[model samples]
Target: MLQISLFRRIVIFAILIGGLVLALPNAFYTRVEQSNDARAVIESGLSNDDLSAVAGQWPDFLPSGLVNLGLDLRGGAHLLVEVQVEDVYAGRLDALWPEVRDVLAAERDTVGFVTREESGTDELRVRISEAEGAARALELVRGLARPVVTVTGAGASDIAVSADGPVLTVTLSEAERVATDNRTMQQALEIIRRRIDEAGTREPTIQRQGADRILVQVPGVGSAQEVKDLIGTTAQLTFNPVITRTTDPATNVAPDEILAPSLDEEGVFFVLERAPVVSGEELVDAQPSFDQNGRPAVSFRFNPSGARAFGDYTAENIGAPFAIVLDGEVISAPTIQSHIPGGSGIITGRFTAEESTNLAVLLRAGALPAGLTFLEERTIGPELGQDSIDKGKLAAAVGLALVIVFMGLSYGLFGWFANLALILNLCMIFGVLSLLGATLTLPGIAGIVLTVGMAVDANVLVFERIREELKTAKGPARAIELGYSRALSAIIDANITTLITASILYAVGSGPVRGFAITLGLGIVTSVFTAIFVTRLFIVLWFERRRPRTIEV
Candidate 1:
């Protein structure tokens, strides 16, 4: 048994009551207008004030429930994606590696990081490519890299290789520096998220898992396949088939000049009418929409020069086909679509509303520099997660009920004090989570249960110590003080060890593991507070009223 001071009891009551009040907004139903007003801004282009106007007001309410559950509990798709670094590098490598190979072979006899490949040398063997092409890819990769050192393959091919669990590993040649791989992966994921979000998904979670793998959780995603389909394929863009060289009206654009004309590596051969026109870079904005007649189309706007060039090009090659390519495959090749002098026109395709939006997303995010593979896809059903939650709740209830019975039987009136503290501890945990906006996953619930059990254990230690202290002829008050003082060291040591593990889990674990670690760590802190402050206060208040000379244990 233990006692608490009157002042402390009042303070505890006030704190608990305040916490519950503050947490009410996170648990109640919120309106659509409120949720929409939340800060969904991921762009820095918009000014804060401008963003504020579009974002609207903050939510005044929340869902009616025991706190919002994570995607696992509600059912959604979970994906582990490996960014296609290899494809990114392959484009640069395929185009420039040839130059490297040629330069290396021509300068084979040179020295001191020379670009020379000797006869009979392995093409991939870095001894040759490194000496010759090192500076070539180095300069280019640098342009795309962050403030990181240059990493390269043994100087052979400048290609991004493949993906490991959490990292998209690029060949040293393309990366120019090991550090850039992470930056590149991060950039790729951001692009992917933008593309997915443009298709209108809400509350999606995208995070880096390991060195190369990306974890994506889309809550309430009925369009799982669509997301994967759009993301897994790399939609790249490049300006090919330059018409600048054409001077004579009868001259035709070289086949190689046409940008990637097909998936088969064939280049386009649009009639050039011996005139140069604008490049695709003139495009400023593009959106997948419907044509004037309501046909599916991609509407695009171009700069001034583009408008003039496009108008001229169309006038000269009136009947020739101009291809609209996406990622190397031509989506449509409409014949001289009538001099769109405004540089704004449509490329019609067979697309549903969702598909149209996804295409728009891809364009808006900027095309990938290379190709990508879906490689793998996995979806987690919310039903399975709900089952785990149910089982976990059952286990927790049974364990808690048993603990309560044991404490009441072993410690009598003092046991009820521990139970009261335990209840307060639970309330504090929920309240804190509500304030923090942390999602409750299945593992997180497990942590809550574990905290409940551990919280009671502390009280048991104190009660047992008091019982033993009484045998030494100490009064109830003296025994209570001694028990707290003596048990503090063990309590701190256990908690410190647990905290260390929780920290590690938070650092190394991904997704649900991280969620669990967070709840568990917070639970320890709250447990200590309730066990020490709240329980002691209750005991002190009881002592003032009862003033028992002896205590039951």
Candidate 2:
């Protein structure tokens, strides 16, 4: 008779069971749909099974012997966005320049236009527009502005707006650029978060990177790809005159540096050739609406700079048309009747309520520094993702069935014990996954299936070893002891190789691939423990209980 202690048997069983428990949580419970009836029963102190019946239970927890589901199975949305701040900044700056120019041009327009004088380094030239009017505009402006940017030539009829060496003509410094970039990035992330959350998307991850960039990830989301259109439009606002090439001579002007927008288009509207009199950058807010004429439109209000620019531009360009263009598409063109110095106004044009709201948000949030050119876009339909999940499930089931049949036929009675151990191995896998919150991707499922074969391999090795030892006519106990000792080397070699692969995959891959690595690695570990110890425990127990003459292979 072979000599093997019961203590050793108990020790093996405990290790195997412990491993199974650890992996069960992650694997079997990918999602637990809590039923209120069940919960109420529990609260009312009912048995779990009774509560389950009253409410409803799911096989959602796959049999104790399977892999966990990953994000794909759980079904969620993933979105990637790049924060293009230049579009907003440049748009804002371009918008502001028009207003500033309009106000500056007012003095000239009212002054009846005069020659510009070159005074040393500073542009201290004068005598252009009406003096009193220029003073009024400057007084309104000098009250609130961007820091202490010098406004030279503000004293005379020609208001020379300048910050001296710090003129708008100069480029931004490293610090300014960096600061601006940080602010843009910061705003982009915050705004995006708000949008995603506002859309009722939860558990999102938003990150900011190099100069005005953000990355957002939303898990457990349905109806993917819709988030893109939600984030990228620029809502710039302006007021100008409507012009058609046929009616306005400038539209048919010689096409050279400034290409006259095609007059053939019904949407084409032109105003005075002069720059915009007011910018939307100064706009504090915008809301969509229906004008008295029953056209969709957006209303807006501006900050100080915008007010002065609007007032001055209107004062000089009175009766001239101004074009309100957004993202290269002219929204409207209206003639200036009276000066608007409040920095607030309305934009009336073709727009739906949703369209208007989006525009308003975009404008209120400020324009992007640069227009977004779709670098790359991919859309995953819900049906497609769901189909993948179905296929993955089918593959897993087929692999598992084959594993069971193969083990049962080849190893005979001993195979029965191995199958049991395999089930335990699966439990170990799921338990660990659930506890650790591991997601099982398709590759991860494959790994688990592959492990079924591997777990069986260990069993086959032990069984063959025992069968070989039985040739010497040893008792079942002695045969099992020798089999386990001999098989340990092969089992170690096989499982270690799998573990190394899992480690590499985890290290190199991202997202789902990483999920695969985690589950696979976990499978290898759980497989080894259950195959080596749990199987041995049952084999030893059988020998002790029966005192069999000879152990079957």
Candidate 3:
């Protein structure tokens, strides 16, 4: 009666063998990781002979994926950054000036001359020459408003325009502010991720903390300050038309122009138009290259719209100078020698090779939505990570040893069968993790150790049930059948309850707590599978071979 079908037996063995095969690559993690990195480099068109050769070291068809280690297991930097969202509001108002001017200019006869007023940085104000025309100007500016894209803001305008005497005040509506803040936060998250990825660091945790904050964690990074520097640089590259060259930095300039000092020349300043002919957002590609004079430079190509704008501006401006500005600083001001119609151009600023490469990386990653203020930063050293890993391994070994010894002593032969299943269960956990590429943290090691003990609990329950059935005058085969049958409900119920708890922990927790929940949840599944099916198969095979009349559980 304790017989397993050929299909069932094959499935159980196949699972055990498949798990071992998949988990084998992790034992040689360094080699596998090297192969993976080499493949990435070759695929990215890096043209490294050594890397390309190493890419084939691991077979293409093998399970080469390894479990990623968390920040605690591997040394890394953690950062809490607060995005300055309000800074965007000031820039937004500045950008809206041109649109407002164009709209009001359409009805200049009715409103008379309109002048922009210097109000609070948070608001945009324009004064009408005729006080009686305030209503008409307000209506024209209000006509520029668009409907808000939020559920709570139905029928509300994007901007609130009010007429206070002759001056019309404009502020971003509550709905628009919410939308802008959300976009800023999401853009910040994506840009941070791209920057870290560009730096070649592995498995960074970039997430939004709140409405105005981001959390960044990078494994194998040298210091937290390095990550902060990489993320905090706005890298807002723009090409603005040169208004004039000036020596006075504080010269009174029009509102549409800004004065920025030259990077290479002393006491030299360039007044540049505020509006950019081409912004970094339109840049599709950027790379480090050498100029005609053999100086390091950055070559960039823009998207279609940007290419058209840049081409038209360059064709018209001919010999006029244009400034390449980055983060409000003038990097270079060069005269347009010819029309650059291909949308590609070089930026030469006496850059070193490393500087050019770094700039290119920053450009390719795109600009941050808002400047980041580092709220908290810390570095976890490799020594600390190694110590944690050693302690975790020791704990797991001790836990596994104790569980195996206890099961061997209590259940005799059946206990040894459970012990074998437990060993296979450990391999299956790692196999699943490697397959999923889940991150393993220090707390995750604790989950595995906890699982080692709980794995035998089902076996204990079944053995106890068998003893009870024997006392009820049941034969050896009947007792074994009844034991497995009746103990099924308790095993399913207990595992399901633990799984639910792990799910809640994973959903609510962040970082290491989530790692713990992941391993705990995975361990529960593997433990249940091994206990209910694998150990039963082993017991069934033994009984089938020996044909025992009376057996001791």
Candidate 4:
């Protein structure tokens, strides 16, 4: 007998109602989006009359999860940026200089006076007064070389040290350079992601394109320039020992000193040591706060190693000024009043609250390992996106209408049940997408349209089987039961094969391909549920109520 248990019917209706409720927000996407944004702001401890009003647009009891629109559907910024990985080579050598200087200085009797010499960007050159000690200096510096920390570079040293006359040159080895490049790219990607996420963007496609390039696509951003502004600042902060302050920008400086302009004071420059006492890499936390004068400032705290170094530097250099540099410009040059042991400090300057907040965000995200050169940039307009949405809606509506008409003409009353199931299947797809926070692209819309046609296949198979079974003199109930039972295997087999394909596409593909795979895979699951269970339940209910003895397909 065609029948569904009372509990099974309740479960089915509960699921259907739950899905419909979850998918309800998408029906008023704009209002719900504004409400969600306003609610987030309120939760972040900010609320105004306008924000409160906007937040009340949707009821508090409803599910607010939305199917995020992809770049193609929402319009956004696209960028192809190439990281300047070579910049790290110069910084690496600069960092290695202090170690080499200290090691050679310890053996001053043999090495004589040591001085850094001008060299290529990738190599560090140190000259000793005594030529006879060149070999000794080379040997000592070579001891500083460690094995590269990569599988392909296991046996290779990080630095190659060689001697020529009285000068010893140290350069990063090829293997180490390759490894450094990989790390640089990884770090750049992470920092970029962090910076964008901090700005509250959604569904950003940030992935490596080539060896040194990244592809960034942020949906719903105003322009590419806005995205660039968010990520362009390197935020490299360091505290350097100040040598002297000068008004002339043309002051000659030593090889180990750098002349940096003051961020707040015009025409004022500070000559500072190239090597920093502590760098921003050691900073564990940064927050927007007020300085002693109650002015907007950024408070920062360092890790243990950074704290120890910072404490030692301040203890030894009381009454001397230290320049707080960010991206090669000194923001503040404050004189040490006493030994500051805690490693917590305030950076005070002429700054507004917004600037301080943005700086805090950047500091928390850490500095980019290398600078980026924008190779390509594009801003997609909202008008174009709206056109795409309109077209996509038309395509989906047309596909749905054709499928509904075909099913109704072919399968009679059973066809109406199948059509209803198909509608619910779409609702379920949207519900699942909202629950997963999946992005919908143009290709994803195509997947939904394709699903509309495919959702009826199982019903078609069952209906045809019932027509055939009726020819064998089986009653309506027996024919219906056998039709569904016999068609189950075929339905499962066909959908399983398609699911495997969708999974593979999702695993290996990116961006639009991924969007398509997600929708297609989700559609298959929902279609099977609506076909085998939902349509069957509807038929069972009709048969139980009407108690029909004769049926026509």
lDDT of model number 1: 0.63
Best candidate per lDDT, number? 4
lDDT of 3 by residue, 1-553 (tens): 6677999989989998999988988988888989998998887878667887788778888889898888998999998999998878877887798889888878888887877877776799888788888888988898899998878778888899999898889999988898888888888888889999898887788878767888888988889888877878999999999999989878988666688888878899999887788899999999999999999999999999999999999999999999999998889998999998989998998799999999999999998867878999999998999999999989999998998898889889999999999999999999999989888999999889888888888888888998899888777878889999999999999999999999999999988888889999999999999988999998888988898878887
Clashing pairs in 3: none
Candidate 4: lDDT of 430? 97
* TM-scores for all predictions: 0.65, 0.50, 0.94, 0.97
Worst-scoring 10-residue span by lDDT in model 1: 116-125
Summed backbone clashes in each candidate are 31, 40, 0, 0
Question: On residues 26-49, what C-alpha lDDT tens digit does candidate 1 reach at each position?
Answer: 544253323343344524333476
Off by over 4 Å in 3: 46-61, 472-474
Worst 10 residues of 2 by lDDT: 254-263
RMSD of each: 9.9, 12.5, 2.1, 1.5
What are the runs in model 2 whose C-alpha is more than 4 Å off? 1-31, 34-71, 74-76, 85-220, 225-382, 471-475
Please rank every candidate by TM-score, starting with the best.
Answer: 4, 3, 1, 2
